[model samples]
Target: MSYLYLTILFPLIGFIILAAGRDRLSENVAAIIGVGAVGLSALTTLYAGLDFYQQGGMAYNQNLWTWFNVGGFAPQIGLHLDGLSLLMTGMVTGVGFLIHIFASWYMRGDEYGYARFFSYFNLFVASMLVLVLGDNLALLFLGWEGVGLCSYLLIGYYYVNPANGWAAIKAFTVTRVGDVFLLIALFLLYQQFGTLDTVYIVENAHVVLTDSNLAFWTALMLFLGAAGKSAQIPLQTWLADAMAGPTPVSALIHAATMVTAGVYLTSRTYTVFEMAPQVLQFISITGAVTLLVAGFAALVQTDIKRVLAYSTMSQLGYMFMAVGAEAYQAGLFHMLTHAFFKALLFLSSGAVIIACHHEQNIFKMGGLWKKIPFVFACFVVGGGALAALPFITVGYFSKDAILGAVYAHGQIANLPLYNCLYWTGVAGAFLTSIYTFRLIWLVFFGQEKTHAHPIKGVTYWGPLSILLVLSTGVGALLKAPVEKLLTSAQIPVFAIPESLEHAVHGAEHTAVGIALGGLVIGVILFAFAYNAVKTIANTGFGAGISHIWRTAFGFDALYNIVFVKPFLLLARLLGRDPVDGLWLLVPALVKGGHKFTSYRQTGLLREYASSIGLGVVVLLIVLIITQVGV
Candidate 1:
């Protein structure tokens, strides 16, 4: 429990130091505080993890104090350490430490925004920790909004760049749609169940949440919130544009930490989703569609970070698909595996960017494999892992398990829907292989497309190397251990069909053979013939195809026409004070009355008395006439 508090405290301390001393502290000291805080927290995370395992990964709720209370309701401010939170906290702190270390080198000599970067970076990690660790949805939402605000600040870290500011605003606006849905779900759950505690709500779901429509929409809203945070489907456009920030920002938010929050949200509240099968079914569909759409989008991206950004979205789709199919273990496993390799891709790309004089277009890079051999080796491991190459990479096992789950789940449904999801996932896998290798070949394969640029020692390359190792077979070794922990924590495993059991486990020779074949076919189709692919990529037809995908299937444009333009128009209409005319008549009448009364006053006491006497005489004459008529 003490270590749990320290996990949050260390990062907060780093944020304070960096923010308060942004100008006073030298870069070295600031870097130490920034990286050291999370580094120490990582060590503490391992300590907490060891204890959690020894305790059989049982759930522990640690409340620091009562945040507030009204009548009988008290939303405790606390940490909930269970199998899911334990793994998430460990991953966030560990991978975040590596990113911080990398940023220390990556952000060197920015006399202006150096400490400011670390400040936002530190707070970002701390906010995510609070998110996964909260005891109740209220605290969780606090953390959720915290990360969103920080994302806005960090994404627009270069406030001077109007484009960057717009990117940040886009992220905030889009995600807020989902956040509203989440808030509604939270209120509904509380009113129905009288509690915001996740454990309590899950336990009482069947008894208190019997209203079908309520449960369905609540679950749907939760999914929407997760989609916003995780950057799935309709809410996903902001993430790719977020690459306007620093590379480490891209790695930390898009690659590892922030984008995965949706998957975590769904998995954490599995029971709530279980109460609403319709919503859960839609979750699978969203996942399948997102994976396929983003996979194609990744293929056409020229910027290396944008490629990884879309890849992150696609990977998140796999997790959503798994959870949607009730494959909790599989979804969580893919999430963990994605954290390693995806971060590797972004971090490795950072080195290549710095080495190539900040050039991002892979078409502009060539023969860099020799100049930056370290980054080159790292990219192969990361790209291969992302493509889910057979036995050697971690993604093969995780992804195979998810696809098997989709197939099995579909078979149980006795419908084509799950079958569609299964094949869509497989197609995405193929597209993933093509785009990832396409990136590798175009960046590191032939003649140097651009001139060489120098890399700062191994300072940044070092973090890429660590993530690279994790992206390879080294991370695969953890799958079994994590899977065991997940099972013990009562996270249900998907029931694989007897015919496909070997595929999920990665144990059968035939399954291994198929994966290897896919890997070779992917390399052949996308990477082997570099010159031919390049020629087509530069041709008119190819340019048209790229244009379609480069606009992200016209989703951005569609949203602008659909949501953005209308909202802006409404804002403009409201800004003009359209109701002011309705209130103008009252003031106009009052002013006229005041002018008539002033005319009657005549500026002297005798004049005022004479007017009063004339009014009395007129009143008397009218009275006499009325009497005679009577």
Candidate 2:
């Protein structure tokens, strides 16, 4: 088989092995199979990347079979390996392997579902690979729903907990809302183009529908699908609650693989988006608003995981902004860097939570820097990358690339919106830095406020060490290749003017300054506020803001009022009158039917026999009469 096939197949093999041997395999063996599958896939992806680089944009399609062939249309089961797929494949497998390894240790003593966890983890990786590598829209949809199913299973792995189950349902239901749009978009595409093949659809979409109006509507509808998958705007709330799952699940799905689906969709359909600049602008605005709203939500969160969850939402918003502005490379580069550090942060926090016996409330615990030095160091490195700390980190390079692209847009004399995007991006960066470090100081550096728990084992430290190295170095290493991949050979239509050169660079510097300043101020403010709150609690005056922040800005309450309450009220009204009245009528209908049927039957057996005999005689006489008449 080709490397492309191997890249997608190994994870399936791993999933099968773990699942079939769930009761027999040792945890160590299962971990190896789980992590090894993704690791091998990652290596295959690297080989594919190198091969693609040498060949200079070759598309590899491996057809397994015809999925469907009917009525002048054919959709096949196949995998497509190209620059875009190669990029996503590498990120998914590489990060997925790390998460699997981390989970091996994280789930060690859980005992109840040890084998099951690896099975789900491997399957999740396989589904994600299928998503990235699928050659046609139908295959892609299969991967789409596959990942959604895996997400629900993994999110509610602790199924005994009602809250985790509910969280899983919420995630599945919310994403389904988006998936509906995606399915509709796909059907519409097939209807218009008569083909589900990526290349064919992209190449012939314009010809299939010559009207610009139709093209715009089609593109806009597809983007709605992307928005839901990418967690942009109104659909974004579920990502925060998704932290109810294990930390590694949070890192893998939220940080690396699943949430980036929308980005991939948009990138793959660049031709479609290019046709609809209005849709593109709408995407940018939605991204900007999500960034701001999620950032505020992050600022108020207390649980360590919830903080990271909101951070993921905010960062995803920045990525969407990059896509909206047509800075595909910048968006993807940030995606790459964000994957490394965010995974590291989440994994490191997992170690902390494990060490603290599952205490996620940062206010209850502090001074962990000394207890878990390696984890603390990893957190700092990850946090520094997240805060875009100067020259040394991956986040700096990628984030600066995005800001630079947005600034370049501002140089277009006629486009005032680019300037707005630039400013919005800058503000996003500053807020990101502030909330990120606030998490850092509150969790790792303050006075120890909770009881101490000792942590054990070499497994915990191993995965974290690997991630730390990547988070620090991958940015500079991938910079040139990423820049080339994103930008076309031809010069861009937009240009940054010399007059605005100072302003652009100055804005970047200002953003950096704000980032650092936010970090410093956040640390000081958290320390002071935490200390004062503790003192006030000792004096009984600390309940107000604490209660508000813990309630998550009342978004849940609003949802309850607007969605839950109204639906429940409607159900109640229907149950009381309309449904009950129908049930009452059902009994009368049953009685009337029974009474009508009684007239056809006789009480005595002889009478029933006579009725049957007379009916037979009448039928025969009628048959004879009809034959004579004919």
On the 0 to 100 scale, the lDDT of residue 584 in model 2 is: 94
Candidate 1: tens digits of C-alpha lDDT, residues 292-335? 89998998898989999999989999999999999999999888
lDDT of 2 by residue, 417-436 (tens): 87787778777777777788
Residue-level error in angstroms, candidate 2, position 144: 1.1
Alpha-carbon runs more than 4 Å astray in model 1: 456-458, 497-542, 592-630
User: What TM-score against the true fold does each predicted structure earn?
Assistant: 0.91, 0.87
The C-alpha lDDT values of all candidates are: 0.86, 0.79
- Model 1 — TM-score against the truth? 0.91
